[model samples]
Every structure is written in C-alpha cells, then in structure tokens.
Target: MTAAVLSSPGATPPSKCFTIDKEYPKPTLPSQTWVLVKVKAAGLNRAELRGRNGDEPAPPEFGMFVDEFHPDPPKILGEEFVGIVEEAGSETKFTKGDHCTGFIYGGGKAFDGAYAEYVICPSQRCFKLPQTTLSWETLGATTMSMWTAHGSLFQAAQLTKGSTALIHGATSSVGVWATLLAKAQGCTVIATTRQSSKVDKLKSLGADHVLLEENLGDHLKKLAPKGVDCILELVGPDTLQTLALPHLAKHGSVVVTGVLTKQWAMKDFTPALIPPTRKMTFYSLEPGQEEDEGVEKVIEQVIGKVEAGTFKPEQFLDRTFSLEDVGQAHEYMEDSKAVGKVVVTVP
Candidate 1:
C-alpha cells in the first residue's frame, strides 16, 4: 500500500510513500475487523487539516496500516471516504466491487487514512451506498455532516414536524445538512450567515428564512413572535450565548456541534426561561459516544429524503480537490469562506 502520512507535527507530510517502510508497518491482513477499500472519493474535514497544521496531534500508528492511536504526529489524516470494496475481511458484510461510504474509525486519526489509492477500515463503520443514486463525492461528504445534523435534530433534540429551527452558519457543510434535514421533517427552517450575499442561496437550499449572523436574535423574534422550536448551533462561545440559548421557544432545544469561533471562554450562563420553557443539548459526533448510537437510523432516513428530492446533498459541494492537494484542501477549510462541503478526489 502506498499512502500519505503526517511526517511530523507542524511538518508537511512527504507527498507519498510506500506502506512497508520500517516506520510504517504492514496492516493485519485477512482479519475480520477490517476491510480493504479501493478509494474513489475522499472529503476534507477540519480535523484532518488541524492534524496537518499541528493544532491537533497525530498518533504514531498513522502511517502504518494499523498502529496505536495518537491525536497528533504519525497518524493519517482522512475521516470520510467513498469507494469500491477490494476485499472484505471475514465478519464483514461487503463483497468485492460493492460501492460503499464509510468513516475510518480511529484509523485515519490513529493510522493510515484514505488519501491513498487504497485504505483499510473497520467493518462496522462501512455502509453499502445507495445503488445507482449517489455520486462518490456526495457519499464521501455525507456521513459526518449528515450524521451530526440528523443525530442532533431527531435523536438528541427530537425536532418534530412544524417545528421552527434556527441554524447558525447555515451555509457551511453541517449547517446545510441541518437545514435540509429540518425541512424534510416539516420544520420551518431558518439559516444564518455573515455574508449578506448568501441569503438567496440559502433560500434556494430550502431555508424558509435567512438572516445575517448578527441579526439572528431579532430575526427569530419577528419570524416566530414566540421564539424558535430548535437551534442548530455550529459557531462557538461568542454566538452560542446570544443566538442559541436565549432565542429558543418554550420546550425548545438547541444542539451544538462545532466551535467555529476563536474564543474558548464561556461567559456566565444565563439560562433562558421563556413563557414556553427551553432546553439545551450538546452534540459531538465522535464514535463510541452515546450520542452516536442512533446515527445510522437517522442517516438512512436522511439518505431516503435525499433520494426522494425532499432534500439535496449534492448541492452542497462548492469545490473538489485531489489527494495530492491535501494542503490546499485544508487551507480552504481554515479560510472559512466556503459555502458548502469541500471534496477530495482520490484517484
């Protein structure tokens, strides 16, 4: 296996390398726990860029097909990938040539990722993609964002039909998914973006209302006259306190998934108690967490919605890059200007 790995913390990874170098050992073969995938499409995520930039640590087992986990140096930097099954270890449901979309559970963060032509992934994390429907780019970007949005809305927050949802950073990857997912469930979707020019684009993507991030509070007040039923909170500390907590309607819930803000400090928690009452739910997409337990069901439902034209995932792709352009991909994420998901094409 030839693959790319984070050479050192803060160091640009060597453009390419073979899998059997002494530092990068061969993965366990013919095992039931892993499957070999011929990588077709890969999506760039914030975490991978962070690892490359030295903000997040890469573990020692990264370059190796299988090694111990590290948050930093030595780890591979891919998370979600779509591909054809080259081989399935025993205990896996997939057969050769099966189209699939999957996350590299602990592997990309702990070991070699999907930036290469082939990658190995845990059997449990993989899913057979919809036949003849989704493109490789769509499948690659679907998991983390869709699962995060779906789990937060339906599983954690229990957003129901006719609910009103205010989604912050509405044009980003997760925000777009949250908007569509909310609409599919019969909710009135409100999306927020700092760029005034993006308002119409958000509306076209199914958002019933679009507000500038600065005006979220006032926008919700006028739209509902009673407060919103749900909040999809993606921005960090600064925006969280004002837009999410206070604007929620009675019995309303807010789900926080990303920390896009620079500040980490938390101001005094002024719990909102409105005429109807409100609740807050913290959402993180990490595997093995209790919040992720029902993610698959939500993904299935969202996938169905996407296929039926009730929601659209392909519309969210703004740009696509190759595996060799990994650095540029990360730069795109860090720049924070993209309106949707940034995909990486793995040849």
Candidate 2:
C-alpha cells in the first residue's frame, strides 16, 4: 500500500514534508464496530495542508484516540473519502460491498488516512450513499465541504426562509455550497469574494448580490439596511469583528466557520463587539465530535437535492490528482488558484 506521510515539522515549502510510502501497511478492523474501506477517491482540505506544513499546530491529542493505534508522530493526511466497504465487523450493519462516503474523526492526526488504497474507520462515521447517478469523485469531494456548510447554516445559524445571509469567501467549496443551499431555502444571499472575476460566477450560483471583500462595509450596509439575519463568516475574526458584527440584525446569528485569513482568535475580542441581542458562534466539523449530530439527515437532503438536479457537485470540482501527486494537490489548494475543491484519486 502507498500512503502519503507527514513526518517532520518546520519543513520549508511545506510540500517537502509529504513523503509517499510504497510499503505502508494496510489497516485492519480493530473492533466489531469498525469497518475497512477500499478508498476510491479522497478530498483535500486546507486544514490538512496547514497541519502538514506546520502553519497550524496539530491537535494536542492526535494519534491518541484510534481504536487500532499506530505509534507514528507523522500520520496519514486525508480528511474525507468515498470508498467501498471491503470488510465489516460483526457488530456493524454495513455489508462488505456497501458504497460509503464520510469523514474520519481526527483523520491525519489520529490515524492513517484515506490517502492510501485502504482506510479503517469506525462504522458509525461512514454515511452510506444514496442510490444516485453521481460519480465517486463528486461524492468524495462533498463530505468535508458540505458537512461544514450544512452544520454552520442549519445548526449553528438556524437559518430560515426569506431571511438575509452574508457569506464571505464565497468562492470556497463551503462558501459555494452555502450559497446554493441558502438560495434553495429562499434566503436572499449576499456573497463576497476578493477577486472581481468570481463576482459573476457567484451570481450564477444564486447569490442575490456579490461584492469585493475590500472595503465591503458600506456595500453590505446598503444591501441589508436592517442588517442580515445570518452571516457565514469564513474569512476569519478580523472580518467578523470589523465588518460582520456591526451589521448583525437583532437576534441574528453569525457562524464562524473558517480562518482563511490565518488569524484564529480576534485581538481585543470582547462581548461588546457583538450586538447586545445578537449571537456569535464558532462552528467546527471535527471528525468524531459531530458525526452523529444530524449529519446523516443533511447528507440525505444534499443527496436528494443533487439527484433532483438542484445541487451540482460536479460544478465545484476544480481538479483531481493521483495519490502519488498528493503533495501537488496540497500545493494547488494552498495556491488559492482553484475556484473549488481539489481531489485525489486512489489507485
């Protein structure tokens, strides 16, 4: 088995740390609740890139929670995958040939990941795909992005139809899905992008209004004079405090989903920054933490939308790389050249 391993820290160019192991051992089920998956395709995430490059610190308890643990510091590095079940433990309901798509709890941090021919994960973490005409590539790319979007909007923000939403970094995978999903729910969406070239693209994706991220306060104020009902703040804390907080409607919610600007915590952040009556919440889709928190329902809804020709995952796939080219996939995601998700296919 060949797996992409991250061994050392503080490596220059980041990609230097990604090494492919030709003889990596295949994983086996550690418990009756576990299942072995023959990976077909895997999705790359920015958090994994940051962890591999030492740009972000690995979770403190990483590699400490796997059922069948490996004693390696640098672990396998994929977060989401779509694959077929090769084996299922006796306690699990999954059959040997079930097609599944889901995320690992800690993935690259806790255990060997999906960047190999096989992956072992708890059976409950896998979501059985519905009978649809979608390809494996689309299903693989949908998990992390859609999970984040669905969780942030429906769970954290509690969005309702006809409400107004402001989404930053609207060209990101989660941003694109959030835009389409919010639109489908009848929300008037105001999406932002730093690149002017993406304005029309976002508009076509159903954003009611599109604005450049630079100096967006006045434009956002004018678009939603009464303030927005919900805000999907993906750009980070700076944008949240300076631009989003000021425009939150009474009882409105702002769900902080990503740190694309690389600033995790806000400087001088205080309760005074938020409106007296509004709410600000941080939403994270950690692999094990929220896997059962209505995720299957969201997955079913998203799949239904896709099957009904309402949501198109294919439109969000920018490129695909082979497992050997996992380093390049990480580079491409970090370069910000891609308009959507970058995926890697397993051999």
Candidate 3:
C-alpha cells in the first residue's frame, strides 16, 4: 500500500515533511478487535498539523490495553476517512464491503493513518455512512466537524426549537454545521467571523444574523439583548470569558467546542464570570465510537438532514486534492487559506 509518511518535522513550507511511499506495508486487523478499511478518501484536520509539527501528542494511557499504537515518526497522518470495510471482527456489528466513515483516535497524531490506500481502526469507532450523491471528498470531511458540531449543540448545550444560538468562528466547517443544525431545529442562528467576506455566505447557510468579530459583545447586546439560548464558543476563553458568556440567556448553555485562538486554558478564570443559572463547559466526543451508541445517532441525524436537503455538505467543503498532494493539503490548512474543510481523495 502506498502511504504519505511524515519523514521530517517542522520542515520549511511544511509540505516537504511528507514523502509518499509506494511500497509501504499495509495494515492488517487484530483478530477479533479491529476493522480493515479500504480508504476512498481522507480528511485533513488541525490535529494532523500538530502531528506533522512533532507536537508530541500526549500518549493515550489506554493504548496498550486496547492494542493501539502511535509510531514515533515517519508515520501516515490523516484523522477522518470515508471508506469500505474490507474485514471485521466476527463479534462486531460491521462486515465486509460495508460503506463507512469514522474518527481515528490517534490518526496522524499517533500512528499510521488514512493517508494510505488502506488503514485499520477499532471496529467501534467506524459506522455506516448515509447513502448520498455527495462526493467522498465531502463525506470524508464530515465526521470530525459534524460530530463536534452536533454533539456540542444537541448533547452538550441541549439547544431546542425557538431558541437563539450563536456560533463563534462561524466560517469553520464545524461552525457551518452548527448554523444549519440550529436552523433546522427552528432556532434563530447568529454567527460571527473575523472576515466581513464570510458574513453573506454564512447568512445563506441559514444564520439569521452574521456579524464581524470585533465588539461581539456590544453587537450581541443589541441583536439578542435577552441573551442567546446556546453559544457554540469556538474562539476559546479569550472571547468566551470576556465577550460571549455574559450574553448567555438565563440557564443557557455554552459549549466550548474549539480553541481556534490557541488558548486552550485561561488565566484568572472565575465561576463568577458565568451569569446566575448559566452553564459553560468544554466539549469533545469521547475519543472514538462508544458503547453508548450516541455517536452513531449523531452521524445518522446529520446525514439524514443532508439527505433530506435540509443541510448541504457542498456549503462547507472548501476544496479537494489528490492523495499524493496530502502534504500540500496540510499546507493549505496551516496557511489559514481554507474557510472550510480541506479534503484529499484517493482516486
């Protein structure tokens, strides 16, 4: 199997770090444990950028118990993939030829991943994807962004119809999904972006309001003075602590789904900053598909919406590249050139 190996870390232009290996050994499944997938396409994620830069991702303490491993260097780097199951554990729900998509726990961050024509993952994390006319390039990008968006809005925030929801970092793929999901639920959606250029584009995606990131607090004050029912805070604590939280409606929920500002934690944080009865917390789906079956339902719901024409994947997919250009795709992402998901197709 051919694979793109992260041969060097922190190389100039970054794309030089990847070297395509035509003769790389393909992965095989562990007896009764994992599924082998023939990847049709894979999505590049911000996590892959960390791996390519040798960020030394915290090793999964549970890896050995689960038979998972993360190679030190020269490993394939891809986090989410759309593919078909070539093999599955007998006791698992999956089977041969099943079309699927999934989030790889340590993909790129830890081990050889979907950057190859083939990859193997724990059976639990992979799930059946909805049948759609959407290209693999678009579907490949859905898992990471959609799962976060859905889980944050519905599960973490518990948003409901007639509610007013605000999405920060509104141009991100996750933000786009949140806008669509919120609107489909009959909620009024407000989105924020640093770019005035994206304001119109976001409104077309169902946001009732789109505003520049500057003075977000004052803008929210005038537009939604009663506060929003849910706040999908993606820009991190800098904005969350100072601008967004005070605008939450009474008993409203704010889920911190991403730290695009790179401030993962905060200084001088105080619970007092949270208004009386309001809730704010960080959010992420448990590393992989869990026994709870919650992740599967989220995937199904989002896809069902897309299938029903209530949501459009084309609205969020920025562009696609051939698998061989995986490095260039990463470059595109790191350069902050993509307004949405950047994907790579195998064919």
- Model 3: how far is 206 from its true place, Å? 1.3
lDDT of 3 by residue, 216-246 (tens): 7888899988988999988777777777777
Among residues 3 or more apart in sequence or in different chains, the pairs in candidate 1 whose N, CA or C atoms overlap within 3 Å are 57-71, 57-72, 58-72, 58-73, 59-70, 59-72, 62-75, 250-276, 250-277, 251-277
The deviation in Å at residue 40 for candidate 3 is 1.0
Q: What's model 1's lDDT at 156?
A: 75
- Candidate 3 at 299: error in angstroms? 2.9
Two-way lDDT contest, 1 vs 2, winner: 2
Which runs in model 1 stand beyond 4 Å of their true positions? Answer: 8-26, 29-31, 57-73, 262-277, 284-314
TM-score of 3: 0.90
Best by lDDT: 2
Which parts of model 2 are misplaced by more than 4 Å? 7-15, 58-73, 285-293
The count of residue-pair clashes in candidate 2 stands at 2
lDDT of each: 0.70, 0.79, 0.78
Query: Candidate 3 — which residues are off by over 4 angstroms?
Result: 56-74, 287-293
Which model, 1 or 2, shows the larger TM-score? 2
TM-score of each: 0.80, 0.89, 0.90
lDDT of 2: 0.79
